[model samples]
Target: MDTTQLLKGVLDLAVLAVLKDEDGYGYDILRRLRTAGLDEVGDASVYGTLRRLFQAGLLNTYVVPSEEGPHRKYYGLNAAGRDQLNRAGKTWRNFASTMDALLDERGVAA
Candidate 1:
């Protein structure tokens, strides 16, 4: 089954979760997501998600000058973002549980 559609719906949550503990620059964030087993995550998608979240006032951004390369703009979760993460997490958990039950009932492996 194609996972792209499902991935689009949860990308925001994934991004928010990734930034929950620490701030990261674009490529850094992408790498972390890939390392976390989200290998299908694309660079542009993560970068765009950061920009969107920042524009939506859900993320904080700061620039750090690099000695070896260009300055990096890092994104971190703010109060609003945290609130969103908490709320969205609850919703996702509920949805996932429901889907799990449905799949089990249908004798389908989750």
Candidate 2:
């Protein structure tokens, strides 16, 4: 699979999942995603996702002063975000399981 394409589909979920652990600024979130094996996640895409999620009211942002550079805008999940994550996670699980079953059936036929 083209990882970039796959990442694009799940970027929102991935971002929300990361924030579930702790709040992070844009660059920090990008670093965490890369470290977590999403090396193909682009800077622009992540930033854009942050902005969209914030505007959608799924995330809350706050600015924090940086010692070495400009202030960073940190993102954290709010109540609505948690609800969305839960719903999305359940949907993903169901979809994945259905796909798995189909693939398994195909393998058996093959």
Alpha-carbon lDDT, every model: 0.93, 0.94
Per-residue lDDT for 23-109 in model 1, tens only? 999999999888988888988999899999999999999999999899999999999999999999999999999999999999996
Per-residue lDDT of model 2, residues 1-110, tens digit only = 57778789899999999999799999999999999999999999999999999999999999999999999999999999999999999988999899889989889552
Pairs clashing within candidate 2: none
Using alpha carbons, what is the TM-score of model 2? 0.93
Model 1 regions lying over 4 Å from their true place: none
Candidate 2 stretches with Cα past 4 Å from truth are 108-110
Best of the candidates, lDDT: 2
